[model samples]
Structures are given as C-alpha cells and as structure tokens.
Target: MDNSNMWIKHKNNRSIKEQVDILVKLTETHKKCIGLPKSKREVEFLKILYPASIRNLEIGDKFIGKTDYSAVGFGCVTSTSGVGYFFHKHKIDELKNNTKDKELLEKINLVEKYWCDKDTQENFRKELKKSNPEFFKKFAKNDNYSCVVCGFSRLSGMQLNYNKLLDLGVNGLKKSILSRNKDGKNDFYRASLEALDLFLDIANHFEIETRKLAQSLIGDKLEREEVLKVSNCLKEIKKGEKPKSFREAIQLTWLYGVVAGVVNYGRMDDYLGEYLLDDLNNDKLTEKEALDLVKSFWKMIAWRKTVMNGRVTIGGKGRRNEKAADKFAMIAMEATRINKDLEPQLTLRIYENQNKKLLEKGLEVISEGCTFPMIYNDEVNIPSVASAMNVSLKEAEDYVPFGCGEIILCGKSVGTPNVLINTLKALEVTLRNGYDRVNDVSLGYNTGKIEDFDTFDKLLEAYKTQLKIHIEELAKAQRLSYDVMKENCSFIYVSLLIDDCIEKGKELLSGGARHLGGTLEVYGNINSANSLTAIKKIVFEDEKINLKQLVHILDRNFNGFEEIRNELLNAPKYGNDEAEGDLMASKLHEYVCMCIKESAKDIGLDSFLAVVINNHSNTIWGRTTLASADGRKKGQFMANGNNPYNGTDINGPTAMLNSLTKLKTDIHAGSVQNMKFSRSMFKNHINIINQLLEVYFENGGSQLMITVVDPKELEKAYNNPTNYRNLIVRVGGFSARFVELDRQVQKEVMERTLYE
Candidate 1:
C-alpha cells in the first residue's frame, strides 16, 4: 500500500480515469459505496483523501481535495462494507484463485477467514434471509421479473440536520457528547460519541495536510493564494468553532457531507446564507467571489459522478435566515447555471411569497436546458409533509427532497425508499389469474380469469386485490429488514447528525430520529392506469371486444391483432385531460397510496409514502413486463413517472398538467412530473411559461422537473458523440451525459412529447 494517496493507501493499480469510470459503475451496480473500511476513523480519512488527486486545481479553486469516486460514496451505509466477504469466504477465495493477476489475487486472498464485528448490516441481511425464508423468497422471486426491490445490500442517503452542525461546532458537539456520556447505558449514543471523536481527528489531519499543500505552492503566487485560502478555511473549521466567513462555512459543509456518507445536503441557503452575509457586510468577500466558491463546491459534488447526486435546497418558507438567505440563493442559482454539471441536483423551493428574482433566476436556469434547480412548491409540500409525517406545519417547513425526489424531515427523520412495487406487473398478474408470463411463474392469489370479470369494476377490484397483496408483503418484509439492520449495524455518523439521537441516546435505525418511516417506489402507475382506461373505453363502453379476446391479443404480443392494438393505443390516454383516462389515473394513484399508507401504519412507521419518481427503471423494468392492453408491446419501456406513456400526451403541456395534478398530492410523499419543451418555446414567451407554472402550483402540483432540449441535438449526439460530449438530458429522476445513457433511455428521451 502506498501512503501518498492516503485515501486508497495504494497506487491505482489502475489509471485515475479508469478509477472514476469504475466508481460510477460500482455505484450504479450496488447503489452504495464500493468498499467498506472496518473503522469509522478509516472511513473518515478515506473521505478526506478521496478523489485522491488535487494537482489540477482550477484558477478559483478554494478547496484542495476533490472526491475521485474510486470507492462507493453515497447515502446508504451498512455497518460494514466487507462483512459479506467474511460470510462468503469460499466464494471470495474461489474468485481470488481464478484471478489471472498476481497482485489482485494477493489482495483477494485476505478474505480467507470469515470475520466481521458482532453487529453489522451485512450480518443482519444474512439473518433476515435465513430466519425469514418466506419473506426472502417473495423478495428474491420479485427480483427476476422485478415486481419489487429491497435494500438488502445497498443503502440510501438520509437528510441530515445542517442547522445543528452549523450552530454547534465540533467542540460544542464534543461537549454534548460528554454530557450524553453521563447516562452511559446506551450503546447507540456511545457509538455516536466515538464517531464524533474520530471525525475531529480527521479534521485535524485535513488541516495539516492542507497547510502542507499550501506550503508547496509558494513558488506560484495564484496557486499559493488559493491554497492558503483553503488552509485558513480549514483552520477555522478544524477546532469545531463557528465559521467566520463564507469560505469556512462552505468548507465545513463539504467536509460534513463527505464524512457522513450522505450527500443530500439539507437547506443550504438556510445554513450558509448568514455566513455569506457576514462576509459581504464586512467587505471581505465580493458577490462574484461567493458565486465562484459555490461553483467550485458544485464541481466538487459532481466530481463524485453519482447518477443521483447531492441535493442542495435553497429558498423556501421556513428558512430561519430567509431574508439573508435570498442573496446566496440567487448566487447558488447562478452557480448551478454556470457549473452545468448534473450534480448537486440543485433544487429550488418556492412559495407564494418567494422572491421574484430568485424564482426568475431558477426558471432561467431550467430554460437553459440544465434541468435544474428542479422546482418544489412549498405551498403543497409543506402541508402535505405535515400531514404525511403527522408533524406540525412549522416542523414540516424543514422538509426537503433527497435522492430522486422523496421528502423526509431534514435532520429529524429517516425515510429510505427501500422497496419498489411495480403496479403494472400486478395488473398483469390480475389479468392472467396470477400468472407472470415474463418470468413464467405464478405469483399472488388467483383473481379469476379476465373473462370472469363481466364489468370494468370487477377488473379494477381484482387489480386492487393483487396490489394489496404485494404491498402487504413488501411492508412486512421492510419492517423485518429494518429491525435486523437496527440490531446489527450502528449508524454512528448518521445518528450524530440527525435529530434527537444524542438527546435520546439512540442510534438512527434504533428509533433515535423524531420520525422514522420508509417510502415505496411505484413504477408503471400511469401505464397501468392508461391500460385500465383503454379496457374500459374499448371493451366495456364500446363493446368492441370481449375481455378474453383482448387478453389473448396481449398474450400473443399483438402479432396479428394490429388493428385492435391500434384501437387501444388511440383510446383516451392519461395526460390528455380526458375524463375517462384521467379518472382512472387518479383512482389507481389513490388506491396505491392508500394500500401503502395502511401497510406502513400497520408496521409502526410514521408514514409510508409512495414516490412515482422514475430511476430509469421504467426502461429496465419494461424488459421484464409482457405486452399490455394499452398497446404497449413486450419489452417496451413503461411510462416514466406520473407522465403519460411516451408519445401519448398529444394535447400540449397544459393538458398534461391537468391530467397529472389530479392526484391528491398530500397523501403520497413525492412524485416526479417531467415535461420537455423545444427551445423555440423559451425564445417566444417567457411570461407564458411562468404563468403556466404559477397555475400548476395553484392547482396543487407538487413538483415539476423540466427538460428543455431539441430532439435533433439529442439524435445527432447519439450518432456523433464526440461532436457534443457535453450535451446532457434529464433521464428520469436525475440527469446524465447524452451519450453516456443506456440506448433505450436515450430513445425514451427522444420520444418524449416536445411542446413548442
């Protein structure tokens, strides 16, 4: 192991660029960090030294270390990364023996003995699979056809309490830890204190390393100045003292995210705005400088290359420093515009009284085709979150969307969307009397054949019944999974940052948060609803074909029934503001929400909310779902989010919103609604776009994620990648390079209905 990199403790054995690409592959594959060190201190040091290369600092770079993303670095953290290695030693050794490279094989040989601490997330999952075979079987079987998914091996990010971190410096936090130690009986609190101690030790090491780097840059004036700026910033934060300037505060903010392993930043304007104000008031920092610092931070975040990166929320109702925060909010908006990187998933929280300039700035960025700062309406989310979490309206003001647009109480709750339920798959099962054609397996209760349902109501009822069974199984499995996680793994770093953990002497997973809950991802809702609507309009209302005949058409993949398939395709679809289709969409959405809520409530969760945010799973899951009544051929992508089936929203953007906003937004946690517009629309009428957004929120639209791009540009990029390496599009819940996306996803983006 080489000491120079310190983070990896070894030379790449691979090139840095190779490492960066591998890091993204690992994250996309496992949905968590790639490697897990044994101790908390080791993890902290790794974060401090990650991305392990800082030699090529930009002209205005104020931070020295940038994360290269060699290892997994995202929100979810199990107790140990390598515990599975211990249990599966033979599997590990077999691979090592198969390795052709001597060095790689030597590294793999270390897993010869199975070893892990007594309590670990890896062990907990093993236990869950062993002790609850029935639950495991259901979850595992769901994976093939992918009716559902769970956080068996990977973890998701949680919203942290940045307010607390800012208010109580490291020294103050240490004092709080000391006070908690007076109780001494709680292992959770003890672990948190120990975690904090390691955090501070790493802080000290960072200060030393930063100052040394500064010293080395003395020959170059500009580099020296930037390095010294970073060093001074580190010095103020190292002792756990309140940051005196914008630089220090931002520096600490970045470090906290790195050490915590949760990249979703909670309400940045609320926490860092005051520091910006102080610097400006004292004439120590200029507006341009502050924006530059923010831009650099944005670069640092994007450096990790997460498909769904950190979210930095700005401008909302409940910010403690609302007036002061507005200045930096505008700056943050500009930074996002300039950075143009897919990450820090810049989000803007808006209310009726929000500053007009800030709102305009955010719109301007989105109009530029950045697809950011994704707008969230406080008018709906505030009250909705309050009802969902059963907290006061004031408390709900702290609510923020983390990865892929799910709301959790920042610093007060832990709500991981650990399971995915495919509503359309359930509909398929209902139609086939519980048979899954794609996976060739029988699942759930047989709800009778489609011909047995004489009325449309009977068919919907059967679909609902099947959906309920899946939801119940998922909720029960999630409950057991979290319990095992709580028993085996200690989320020390997370507990230290989230609320009431130290105060109540408990860890995050062990009931330390003020609110504890989970979220479920529901895919194919729009497609299934549309299919149901088609069945109602064509089969029941028009009496064009019998249920059995339609089922037969779908079963044969519509090979010889092209006219029937076209009729179904032409049936009134969701997102068209048509009563027949919109009503069905509303009904299915409400039913899914109710089932999830009840199941989550039964398991003692604060709230079990459903998110319709698509993680490009519509494309992946489509491969596993057979043909449907909606004229969707086998292996075609499902609808993305609450949006209508691709190419179906024929009526324009307003009608799309009319169809989408029909849902009771307050009941479900979050949903993503994506709309694409041609560049001409922005060139023609900015006011019309603004008014459209205003009316949507007034009508109860919760969130709007927009992408403004020309279809020709994307097509050209697809064929000639080198000509436009920087072109990006919003794939689903997140954005990525146009050429880097899966071919099917790129096709989906092209097929999105473009409003001119």
Candidate 2:
C-alpha cells in the first residue's frame, strides 16, 4: 500500500492543494451559521440551498470542490464541505455566545417565511396524531413521561440503492428518469422524474466545473496533468455513461449520495471493486494512488460530524462483482490505519471462507484501540436476517447494518426502529396491578396482583399479556404514522434510489420497497429477566421473603431492606451461564419475539422485529422505571443492551458470552452485545479472544460490539477529562470520547468487568 515516489510527485501538486483549500474555506463559512437563530436562519439558508440542490453540480475554476477519485462529495445544500447535514432548530444552542448581527438575523427570518418548507418524516407524527388522536393518546397515556410508553420517535438512516448506480450506470439511470416525464404522468412518476432530474443536474454541475478548472490549469505542468485527469472523469459521467475509470466511478458514487442524503455506502468493495481492478489491470492507476484516494475519501466521511458516520461495508456474501473486492478490502483496512479518523466506519463482513488476513487486519485495528473496523459475522447475520425479514438467502445477502446495529435490506427494505418498548416496565405493571409506581399512574392493563398468581408460570403469563398489548398498540401507531408520511411527506430523492420504488411507480414510504417493516427496540432485557428470576426463586421457590414483603421493599425503592436486597441480588443472575437464570432469559426473549411477530401481522406490516440495540436508551428508560425485584434501586440505569445489570455478571467473559447466546436471535432483526476487555487480556490472550468470537457467532450470536480499554485508564480519563482528550470507547452502537459521555454512562463503562 506504499508508493513513496508517487506520493512525492502528488504531495506538492497544486491541484490537490487547491481542492483542500476550497473545502476548508467552505467548511469554515458553514460553521459560523450554526449559532444563528433557526427561524431567521432557516429561510435564508434554504434560499441558498434550494438552488444548490437543483443546480450547483458544476466545477469552479479552482480545483477545491473537484475530486474525481475521492469517496465523498463537497457542496451539500445545508452544509458546505459536507461537514454535516441540514441543521435542526434544537441544535442552535451549542454556541457559547449569541451572534451580534441582529439585522442580518432578522432578514434571514423574513426570507425563511416565504420559502416552501420541505417536510421531513418527523412531520408524520403530528399528522398521525391529528388524524388519530386515540392512538397517540394510548401510547402517551402516562402523560408522555415514561420511556416505556412514550417512545414514538420514528427515524431512519439509509443504505443507497448502489445496485442501481453500479449496474445501471449514470446514463442508464438517466433513461429511466427521462422516461417518467410524459404528458399526463401520475404524481409518483412526476415526482420521481423531478427528483431524478435534480440528481442529473447535480452531476452536470460537477462535470462542467471540473472541465473549466482543468482548462484554466493549462501551462502549469503537474497541476494541468492532474486537472485534465479529473476533467476526463467528469466528462464520462456527464455523458450519462458508466464510469470509465476508478476515479470516475468513485466520484459518481459520492455525488449521488450527496444529492440523496444517504450516508451508509452499502458494500463498497462489491460495487466499486470491479472498476478498481480494471484500472489496475490496464495500468491506469497504481495501488498506492488508489490507497491515497481512499484515505482522502475517509477524511471526507469523517467531516460530516454526525453520530453514525457513513458506513462503507466491504466483503459480504451476495456481492455481485467480487472481482478485486478482496484487494480493495485489504486496502480499505490499510487506509483506516493511515487515516485513523472515527468514521466512514469501515465495517468488514466475515464468514467461514473469508480472507484470514482481513480478519487479522481487523484484529490489528481493534488492538490499536481505534474502535473500528467493526466486524459482522455473515455466518450468523445472513441466516438471522433472512429469517427475521422472511427473505431468501440470496436476498438476505443484501442485508446492511444501519445506525446502532439494526439490519435493513440495502436496496429492498425500510426497517427503522420506530418505537421503544420497556419490558422491565411491563414487569413492574404486572406486579402492581397495572400501576406505574415511578410515574405514579396506571399505564398498563390491570391483570390482578402478583400475590394472586398461584404459580410462577402464571406471573410470567401475566407479564407476557402486558407485553403483547403494548406491542400491538405501538405497532398500530407506527404503521399509521408511516402511512401519513407515505401520503404527504414523500421522500422523493430517497424513493428514486431505493428498490421497487421506480418499478411500482410509487414512493418508498408508500409500500414501494420490497419489504416494509418497523423495528421495536426492546430495552432492559437482562434487567427484566433477572428480576423475574429473582422473584421466582426467592419469593415463590425459596420462600426467603413473602410476596407481600418483596412488594413492600420494591415500593420503598429497597430502602431499609438492605439484607433482603442482598439476598435478591445474590440469587442466580443472567450472564453467569447458570441454567436457572439462562432459562428465564430464554423464556422472556421467546415471549417478546412472539409478541413482536404477532403484532406485525396484526398491523398489516410485511415484517416487524425486535432490536435490543438500545443506544443510550437503557439509561433513559431506567429513569422512569421503579425499583425491581432484582434489588435494583429506582432511577438506576437499566442493563445495557442484553448485557447483565451493572456489576451483576459475576462470572467471567466466557460464561457471559454463553449466556448471551441463549436468546433466539433468528426471530429478531438485531441486538447489540457490549463486552469490555482489559488491555493486557486482549493483547496477551488474543487467540483465546478470537476463538471465543468464532464460537459465539457459530452458536448464533447476532452482533458483538466490543470495547477494549484498561479499567485504570478509563477511570483516570473519567476523573481527569482534560488529560485523555482523544480516548474513545464504544457505547452500545457507536463510539465517543470517554470523557464526553454523561456521568452515568461513564460509570457504566467503568463498571463493566475488565476481562483479564
């Protein structure tokens, strides 16, 4: 991956330097607008953005915005240099001081009022509430206070229809776009053409700009040579043809993503690998140059400054063009080693026959504690996703992991986690006859008191009933909200890129995707399971405490009952691989999955599955949950994503792994497993760690999100934030600076047993 001579020649070149300068200028300019009042600034901002989206696809005389081989595009409508997406009103206060330009701000407010608003998917919530007040009221019955009940936010991240881009090429897509603009065209056709035309216009803008910049660089020997290369790449795309060079292919890919606001690059090695191999074979580019371009692109991806960086997945089954994908995957690994930036989160998919060197490289990256390239097991996920999505093995091969580890078919499905349900809260309601002690309300259905249940199975049955009702009500709410979005706030650009949309002549939101599903994020799994086990053992089986006494202790938040709380905590816990606790976990997981599947069918959805990847919501949900029979005090953060409650996984890492594999992952979309290893353990017992992972995946573990850090170092960082400014740790689905997390999150990280 090294070519020092090539680097020397291009290192001091003017074209590349100028491109960086332009990007930096644009980024700086965009940063200043962040603090401006949203109402005033939104209109002024959109006025500029509307034309940029519709027009500004051409190149400038300078090479700043022109990069034919780069992985990311410049000049997004909302943010210049692709620093971030459109700003939301709530983010205006990150500023330490107010902007002094009063008159300008006022003018911005006035201009914004006249501009037509682009309705986001979030608008559907308001519309759904307006149309069906009863549905919203049902979920919002607890005065919109409980994370268990009031979890109704529907947000989705995307993986572009790269198959369209890679297989059809720019020209082929243009033919489809143009065919739609006939007289008397339906709204779907008209909107699809409008969106596709805007895309082409954007392509032409970059092409023209690149050509002009190349022409201006004449007589400047080295820079002119480089600029013309860029110009040729752009001209190829402008002609609506497939990319003739690796550079042109990458440019087309980035620009399309920019226009569509789709960040995750679905199986890049599969899509772009063929062009790269062709270029290498034809002596058009060297490995070093390709590696350099990838690194540059990696930098662009990191610039977005969003929570989930654009995921560029490499090496998965069902990849159409597997030509030089392995070579590119290796190069991508090397590029991450060089760039060391947090995102373009390079995720590598591994199976039994995957290149061993690639796995070794991924381990090396993890060893360096960069927290990426995140590994996914095709052996487990392929089958798991196939079953959950009810798709064929070949179709399931297109499954891509989105933000926080939810699986959605890349070009074929829309499976967003639209609502969150707290299983632990259901347990609480079951115990107290439908009363929510924490929120001081009656939120769930009254199923009689725990004392009335003669057997533990009866108590479990009551809890199951509550879960089914909650899931049914929530699923209906989400389906209705999505229908409103489909009817009114159509995602035109997104529709044009996703599959079956153009084929059906309908929007992706409007049943155009091959599979339409909603994911319910079920948080506090281990917490609830452990609580049920404790109650079953101590109260019903052992008779260490009567049912009435246990209820009294729980209601008092476990105060003045330290001895009983200890007894409850000492009861067999999950993550210990004990049969008693593991059996309970299995039963609870089975019940949740059963309810989710039934609710999906009841609500007329193609698929609905549970995702236990509760990114930071474990803590949020804990805020509204009362003390449990597991001896957990009220308001304490719940367990983190199928992980055991804090300090409760008394057994070692292997036992914990075994316990996690107890759940039925095939019936679910995805779940996150967070495990921490001490630096010494990871470094010393690397082979053991590798074998453990292989066994876990082979045994049907869905996803493993590991955070390797020394407990001492983490504690130090938490105590002295300024000393370890760059220390990062994986929290659920994403990684962040260790010191920047909330105090409880930081504590949670510290509490995770550092395997040694």
Q: How high is the lDDT of residue 423 in model 1?
A: 82
lDDT of each residue in 462-502, candidate 2, tens digit only: 88888887888778776875764554334556666788877
Q: Could you estimate the TM-score for every candidate?
A: 0.89, 0.84
lDDT of 1 at 153: 34
- What candidate 1 gets wrong by more than 4 Å, as runs, is 1-61, 64-107, 112-128, 141-145, 148-155, 183-185
What's the count of clashing pairs in each model shown?
A: 7, 9
lDDT tens digits by residue: candidate 1, 456-482? 999988988888877887776667657
- Candidate 1, run of 10 with poorest lDDT: 1-10
Candidate 1 C-alpha error for residue 597, in Å: 0.7
